[model samples]
Target: MTETMREVEAGATRELRRYAPLAANDNREDYSLRFAAVSFRRWRPFVVATAALGGIAYLADFAIGASIVLSFGFTSGVLAILAAALVIFLTGIPIAAACARSGVDMDLLTRGAGFGYLGSTLTSLVYGSFTVIFFSLEGAIMAQALEMALHLPLWLGYLVSTLIVLPFAMYGMGAIAKMQTWTQPLWIAGLILPFVVIAVREPGRFAEFASFAGTDGTHGSFSAVGFGFGMGVALSLIGQIGEQADYLRFMPPKTAENKRAWWTAVIAAGPGWVVLGAAKQIGGAFLAFCALGVVGAAHAVEPIAPYVEAVRPALGPMAIALSALFVVISQIKINTTNAYSGSLSFANFFSRVLHRHPGRVWYVLVNCGIALALMEFGAFGFLNKILGFYSNVGIAWIGALVAHLVIVKPLGLAPPYIEFKRAYLPSINPVGFGSMVIASVVSIVAFFGAFGQTAAAFSPLLALVIAMVLVPLFAYLTKGRYYLKRPNTVAGPDVPAALLAGTHECLACGEHYELPDIADCPAHSGAICSLCCTLETTCGTACQEPGAEPVSLGMPTMKLS
Candidate 1:
């Protein structure tokens, strides 16, 4: 035993030295490739909140609303917005609160929320796909504006729009926060200016909008089927909360001095994004209604045409320039977010699956590359079909996640606090994993018309319901045993609270890591960072005693000397 202990110590020392060079520049890395540890989470609450909410100003909401309005008319379109908003708001509250409190990103939150370590990888893929799809959609919108304003070829415009966001997203949260802050005032003014002008100058247009029949011949009446279909399209934005969570993770740790600010930031930047988004959708519907005659039905759903038409009455020939600028600005802001979040998602997914993380920056390029390809493929042309199908999987993922966080955890069917580190979690947790699978399969089938038209239209709702129901059911059936693979043993009353909340030198990497990222490594008989733990697949189960319950490094272990 003494010889074995010596060997472990020597091995740990060598490992630590091996990573010393990388550890020296750790601060510059922004914790992007790994957990956002406490020490690195130094941004102010309001700044992070502003950055998060800024991404919500995307013009895609306008396009989404206009498309629905064109298909379902004003009444059904408005109803769908309201229904989707309610669901998004309610579901988003708990998720946002939990993520903000834990200071973990959506990927980490999903890990502890019932989808175990490897299980959550599936969700990472799903979330990553959402980012790429939206990135392409938003990029395509920008390209449209560029094409209109500069008369650039569509292909060139797409390339320009897609590449412009690379520098902003490359730097991650710090740069993103600054960019969002700088553009917030301009975006808000631009977003509301045309609407205000139209409301005042063309009061009759509002009345005209109310009575306008859609191209689909839906008239200005609500149809249940139409509302259901529209709701599904709107619900696709539910995944936007995941992007929001990515920013919320940067919120400063809550303290008595900033408690109010923290909660405000959490609420405003979290689910509160939907509040602005819902209004934008409704505005888009009205704008599209106004533009129907000028731009015709075919171009009505395009945000550029509607905004240009609205501003033309006021700004005259400059309408094209101003609207193009607005679209470009909006697309840049949202696409940066999409690319950044997608990079994080892909980083998380690939790190676990491949056990190799080149860097977050590398994945940024990968995400943009995929989205660029999607743009070239004309993803924007099939917006409804794409979002409609994607919503099923997205809804299922969020539904299972929220159910675990709000219901299963509260009921003691799972651990209350999020345990994200790979060492403490199983590779798969059926409660969330199985729930997502079942919900996704069923809803996707319904979406593809395996069910009747009404059911097909309401596939996203079905996904949410099914996943929400299954999560609790699975938790109860499994007795929540899979929630944690071991008891947390690295954090407890025995360890100095300050030490747990402060920094520690990782035993394997010789890197200074925040307490949340540090875990006791029994193999090394010292502290190891979560990233090192994840990468050390050859360590075996040396951390646990034979036949003893696996103890997580973050919880109480045998008292340190």
Candidate 2:
């Protein structure tokens, strides 16, 4: 080989090494920007489901429940919580099923479902924002516990809470699964203890909670406006399905032997998260009510204070210490997830936008760093305002995605199966992306009270409805031509045993990837893994054009004879 050509090959090898699979580094990356290969999906369905379930162990539900009841009273708050949960559950179903079946993360699913390959980057930011915002909220809760138990400054507590989860989150799913599984028992015990103590020591408090007027002094009875506003706040959590799918993508392929377990795990870990989430919110409302007189309304919404007060009767002096430990444990379980999923979202966003990916571990620091900054600024203080505003945008994105998956695809308006590869997709697809934009703009206007108070209160509901209608409308208008730029040339029934069990060698990275992760690259005249395809800037999306010339990676295109 010529010396200059050898130098170019070496440089290319180093560049490819940067995006190589985690096995090259002796730590599995859990496939941040690529398809979850069948060979790497070693966890059983139930185990994967349990790990996904563990991410919801945050104390945010307590605060959300307490805030809603305080603002809307018991009648409106409880009803609103249920209403939001119902919406979240229904929307979560199709997303969860698609991710599990296709072994793709939420971002990849968005690319194929409605948002085109490039258009889904917008949702990546939306999903990424959800993680950082919640990470800050959860970290603030842990900081409060630190201040109460250890006498640490809130700033120091924020740093501790942020830094503590980095090691666990840095390793991805393998470490996360173990941490979640080991901590599951303790977290569950801590979750139930305060409620159990209140039930026994103050039985009447539960019954009296129903009649209590809110601190707002006007929502003593159910008000439609109050319910709508409260539901909007609750609906902010709709983006959490993204976090759930990050884990569900790792579920072992469903088979005849494990079909029951597979379906059960998917449902329970997917939409069923909201079941426990709703119950925790109600529990938070009840606990806040019990502690209202002791801690005052301002402090009642903080989970640490209310939980400490609730268990004080049972454990006497030890309540403070145990509750602090519980808070710390709960925060760790969730913040790790926030950091982990946030890194995935960030990785996906930057990889597509920059055509470069440093690694998933580096982005964990970036995610936690952003969360720490939010905590230092007192994110906990304005929890309702932040969540309420975020709901309109979040619901629009999720609703459009769910519509494409459930409605457009089923009605034969769009593709029958998910196509996530950039090689076979255009830079933008109007079906999902257009719907989300229209819905978000309309709902955001409503949220600002442009229409009326009632409209402002129910803005997120408007976003969901509009997005659902627009997906099919846009699909029909465009004739679904925008969904795929090219037909599958590598992994389909036309190729025997396609994507079932074997691996293909990627020409750019020179690494073997499972069939699902491999695509025939017109630019390279060989198979390329999804990550390599995503990181290739020089190809100029040639695969999407008919009879396009082979474009090399920063070198002249060489046609192999």
Candidate 3:
């Protein structure tokens, strides 16, 4: 234990070098490497705020909500959505707080939360799946916008929307924060206008909407199988928090002086996003109902189409222009987030699996490339099934992370502050990784036909519960050693003798960070940024500790003190 403590203390402390660009694109040696700098660390509050809002893109949410209504009717769909929001709220708080507190992105946060070093690679895949899948879905929706608004071909419009944002997302926060802020107000008004107009024009639609039969034409009541199925579909939003976390990582450090704003920002941007999401879901339902006469039920369930038809009754030309603008703006806002997070996920993926990174820009291309391919194939067709299936893995990942943040930290089981620096962690921890798998397996089985029909209908809810419970179970069984191979206390607070407390220049990106984010690259034998550390694929995590212990399982008996 003492020996391990000595190593941890030796590496834990670090001092900042001169401010340099963090998360820089390093495409030279790694071919797909990206590194973040500490120089532009502090961002204006509104930038963060708008960027967070960008995830609200794709009005497809309305479609998703309407899908619930079409499939299950109102009562069950609303109930399932409410229940899912509650679960995401409970589950999201810890994960969001951890990311804010640790100053790490989702991938880095996962590593410290319990995923371990390599353990988080799987999470990168899962998290990346959310971003890219949503990217294509939202982009496809954008293509629809162009076709509806400008009579463009679907394939050409898809190509246009996908390539359009490459420039903005390519630059990371520098570009996106501005774009999000500039467009938020317009998008918000455009989204709400249809609802306002519809309220005045069709007073009876809301009341009549409640009794509408399922899209499947089944007369399933509140507890009917169709209702459960609809709710399950709406409940697929279990992982939207991943997008929220991508933006929340940029949250300015909270302080006592700004306590109110800090708390408010965290809540509004974090778990609180569901308020907006729920409203959109309900709005989607209302829009679908109102559009019954114009677009009919077949296309009513489509979010943007309903709004276009709903507003057409109030304003003809304006409705078309507004809907087109809303769709485009929303898709851009949301897709930017998707592209950003996907790039980060791709970075984590290559760094862990291939041990080589080219640059942030390269991964951006990689993720976009995959999304484009999915579009060419029939990704939109499997939207619900894919989301449902992916929700299992997402639930497990969130469950493990939440367990660490809400459970282990609060109970004195894990360290209070997050220890995310690579030098002090083992390659993996089983508590999070193992438990996530268990939760995913159980929930997925239940999602399939393994359980009764009703359970299968709401399998995501089951998955969420099971993942939440299983993560901590595995953590306790592991005795918590797997959480960290080395303790931060080793180097001591205020200052330390060893570790990279002294300044070091990054050999790859030519930036500077603390020893915590900097590691000696064996290939270069020089200090490299954490992003470069990850992008360096040739080393194969050689600097990382052995065994790659499953975070959901347990670490070896070896103690870190």
Candidate 4:
């Protein structure tokens, strides 16, 4: 035993230069690539949910809502919005639960859900793109508000908008949660004020809005083609659940005592976000209808223009200032989340590719920098075009994730719990990765009109169907062998209470981690933390070799000083 202990001590720490940033934990880097430690999961269910839900404050919903309604007319647009909302809500349920219960972010969850280690790097790219794209979109909205209210040049406003969110996001969840909580009341009030004013001041506008023919001259009649196209646009927001999971992973372990609150928070802040999102879309359509005569269809889709018009009756001369303020507040609340989650996604991607993790904070610059560039090039000008196309890829990725979590896992075709540790997972799992790729390729081809106009209009829906079908098909065909490279019987059961019950000292980092984040390692000759497992390069996966002692499956036997 003494000789074995000495050998373990001499095995080398092998800490990555990049992991220093995460080790600092000053900003609660909060285990960006590993399980969110139970020790740090201190927030109440409601608080975490609030922080997650707060990320949806971006006015892009308004833009998306108005654009679809204006292009497709009232009936088709409204039906499409409701339909997309239902899809997002239902899919969000299992995903949100899995992430929260596993204490891992979307990227980690993806790895365990059948994408394997390197396979999920693609998803990291997909999710990171979602953040950057939306960051640019939300930043553009705020920039417009700045330009409108203060005459700031669009370029300068973009710069200002980009700079403003850095301080809040740099500090990660602690700072972000407080900011989101503090601003929630004001945002809610501002959100509803314009609609209330419209209702009271112009009671007949609602009736008029219902029958408005739209810019396409559909005469307000429902068109199947228009509805399909509109639904595709709305489905782009499916990626928003990933941002929610980033926060939801920090949820405290659900207990019998907090069960009701836990479920409520998970549902409301998790999948239930689309409920409010759908309402906001409808409200945006209403506001766009109210402003159509004043601003014309071109400017009506810009959220600031319709918002200013909607509140003009109530606020009079102050409408512009208040509307600008609301826009700024709303954008800040969401853009911080975008930058924050983007950093997480990028950090996960590069860490695996480069085998180094400089930390989550540095990637905030990468995320925001990319977004700022996008704004400069006018990504917002192609709002519908960009979102419409992105919806296909986004839905395909999300659809595969949801199908694995909700269907295959329940049906015993995949692991019952998440297995995210790199030491124990294969480099790639074809189940999810292959499904997402095939679905994305096929749907994108359809989106580009290769499959006819109607197919092009509904490409994203096609992606969803293909991905959902493929997850179970691939899982069964692979016989669930690829889900985990090795079984994990170490520490304890994967339940929240069991995972949070004890701590193990990671031999590589000399830090204690909860059971869920620590794994046995033959290469290190001791138990190692997941982050250390991810960054270690010299091991060459000796732990996973045939008859290699199966270190990750059983508890570590080495004594810890």
Candidate 5:
């Protein structure tokens, strides 16, 4: 070989060495919260359903909804919540499908969509923010329940609430699935008993509730400004779909026989998360109405206290005690999810940013730490406006994600399925990433009254709209090059037996995957599990088998019409 050719080869070898770890996994930690080789995916459909029910973890859904009602009255609160639910349902479908079909996390999907290898760091902040911020909120609710029923000190309650989660989380999904399944009946009973007793005792109160004016003193009339304001807050839950997707990834392999169950689980857990969420929101509004009159308007929106009161009419003092239990259990159901997904986001953040693969558990604790810090700083008092405003940015990110997954990919403007192996994808795809940034900027501007009070009030929704339109526009103009770098040839292929031997270990996380699920990772110079593929960072998009796909290199394309 010529001297220059030898130098080029040497450089190529060095680059390969840097990324060689991408193909391997650290079996030492076993994919963090993941269930490495477990076959629990084979369980009955009911388990999946119950697990999906766990999506009802956040207390803010109810609190936020109640505040909307208390601020805007029934018409605005109810209507705004319903509207937000509809939007969330539509957006969550494609995102959930990508998770189940590809069996990768949201971070991986974002990487392939348009954010280059390093570009996804922006999303990492958004997702991690969602996790930690919500964790503090949920943990605070847990503390409130403790203070109300058990009379525990607020600070201690916070400590208990936060620490209780560590044991369950460290065990990962095997522990979570079992815990969720076993607790479903108790959780259901706790959630319903208050309503059941309320109906028995306060049949006349609900009629009174319909006409109850909010703290804002807005009487029974349509207020466009209030409606817009309420929606700005309600729309923040759109990214809760990420939490749903986290669990949905474990859906067992779909086949013709279990097709019905699989689709039900996917839909129920995916978009259907909002249905239950909407119910909680409405119930929260109602409960706030019930309490606000008695507790003063400021305390009216607190669902836990009113819920305890309603249960007391029939269940007696036992209800207060039960309220305490309800708070802790519900928080556990949701916070595990919050912490779990948070950890995943941080893993994505640090892995992509620093080119290091810490165990997912480490990031989990890190996420929780940030949340606890926020709690100590008194974030709970400002939860309503805080969630409302943050929703704008959250919606922008997820909105772009959903747009690419549903709108762009289906029209042949982007890739058909998620390409997340890092080897086959570009370091950045501009379609999803650029659109999200633009959407966030515009929505944030609108939020700040730049476009008038009405527009500023409902900026989150605006962001969502902007991302939906811009992602497709960018995809069309860029010819979908932003999605991947090398053409995708790994998935939907005949597998080599040696690769799937069920014993082939990945070099990064150092674990073995079923041969069928394992793929050769040129980035790491070894086989890699799908999860590790997402967690890898050093590999540039060089595993496309040489022109097998148009990933991120800005190559010219040939039309296939």
Candidate 6:
């Protein structure tokens, strides 16, 4: 090579090396990688799974149930909850299994499933937005509780609830897991006490609640249109499975001895969250009915009023204190997951688009700041409209993703294993990207009443149906050719397969990474980590030929020993 060309190559290699270990020593805990491959002894699968499942204990279920019941009658509200649960559970099973088995986060899984490299960036944005929206929601609920108990202003409570999660979320999964586990028992006790006391002390209330008519004059009757709209609102929560997968990715590798426990953890912590959530929603509806007389129908939809009423007969004046405590604890648990997961999503997104790694901690702050802003702007007041619109996009994204994982891969139309590495994937895959876009646009138009009230009520269902159908159709049309750009050529005898089993040091920055996070970079002439690969903008496809095999650069391979 000429002297000028040689100088350019040297400069590029140095830049590549500098990007490799951007956050090497940082306490990622469980922020970025799918399978961090930390010692199983340090975090048992069962414990981690329990912590993950416990995040679902937030009181938003109560508010959702009450809102639906007040809008629709009890029967229609119950049916909607059941319908949403069934869809969430069915869709969640395959996603949970795929994520746990492959040890990849949702964004990584999206890339491999069908979206391809840059195609999944939109999904990262969608998923990240979910976190902020829900974080604001849960924070708003806590703020309401604060207003009731301590006579604090709602605005200041919003700030308190939003900021409280920062210190814990910054530590990542380890801190989150411990907090969830520690607080779970108290939360469960607080949750059940009011219900048990109410039922035992007042059996006649059940009859009254069941007979109560909603404000819409449904008189305990079911409305198909109302049921569909309620289901759409509930279905907006389907993206929560992505948060479950965030923790499931850290599950200990399934083994022969602990296979049963592993499956139990995966099921309970995964789709099983919806089962409990559905029951909680029903309970909330019941509580709202009982409190309708006390709080008046206008304020009945708020969880604080119902919860305070439920325990008032038992705890008397202490009811607000206990209720506020429960709300604060519950919101803290779930919001931490929200903040942590949002940071990871933002990291994946900007790392790819901006070609830089500023550490997941920075994104944690950004996600929280956005959520706090949303809360300050009164997101809670427009809960229905916001979630109703967001549900279409969330369902479309998950529908296409689940179909790719469950149907296309099984039918052999696409690669069975997820191909997440940058080198092995294309920049875009038409199946996932095209399907999501078409589904979102069509459903959104219908949601705005272009197709009448009935069609608008069922917009989420339309998005789900369209995306699911299109993914398989597109897979067949493309013959799955775009799934992988090339086979993974990073693994070989030179790099002991055992090294791939645990952590391996990147040849570029000499930073350690779990197997899933590293890939061979012919441009750098070594094993490059994913963050490093993402930050490299000038490699110019030096890693592979157009259609043939990956060309090796004869660089010395790093030995694990």
| Model 4 pairs whose backbones collide | none
What would the per-residue lDDT of candidate 5 be over residues 488-551, giving only the tens digit for each residue?
Answer: 4333234342332234555544444544344466655656655556555446445655654332
Q: Worst ten-residue run, lDDT, model 1?
A: 1-10
* Candidate 3 C-alpha lDDT tens digits along 43-126: 755567567766765676887777767667677777767776777777778777766554567787788777788888888898
Model 4 scores a C-alpha lDDT of 0.88
Colliding residue pairs in candidate 2? none
Residue-level lDDT tens digits of model 4 in 310-387: 888789999899999999999999999999999999999998888777678889999999999999999999998899
Model 6: CA > 4 A from native: 1-22, 29-35, 38-42, 491-499, 502-504, 544-561
Predicted structure 1, TM vs. truth: 0.93
Whole-model lDDT per candidate: 0.83, 0.88, 0.68, 0.88, 0.71, 0.82
Lowest lDDT sum, 10 consecutive residues, model 6, at: 1-10
Model 1 misplacement above 4 A: 1-13, 17-28, 492-499, 540-561
Model 2: ten consecutive residues of lowest lDDT? 552-561
Candidates ranked, most accurate by TM-score first: 4, 2, 1, 6, 5, 3
**TM-scores across all candidates?**
0.93, 0.94, 0.85, 0.94, 0.86, 0.92
Superposing every Cα of model 2 onto the true structure, what RMSD results?
A: 4.5
Query: Backbone clashes in each candidate structure, one number apiece?
Result: 9, 0, 38, 0, 26, 0
lDDT of 2 by residue, 1-561 (tens): 001111156455323334434424425477888888777789999899999999999999999999999989999999999999999999999899889989999999999888998999999999999999999999999999999999999999999999999989988899999999999999999999988887887789888999877986777899999999999999999999999999999999889999999999999999999999999999999999898889999999999999999889888999899999999999999999999999999989998998877778878989999999999988899999999999999999999998998889888987777888889888889999999999999999999999999999999999999999999999999999999887775664354553346777677776777777778887677778888888887889678677764333221122222
Query: Candidates 2 and 3: which is better by TM-score?
Result: 2
Residue 180 of model 4 has an lDDT of 98
Runs of candidate 5 exceeding 4 Å displacement: 1-40, 492-511, 514-561
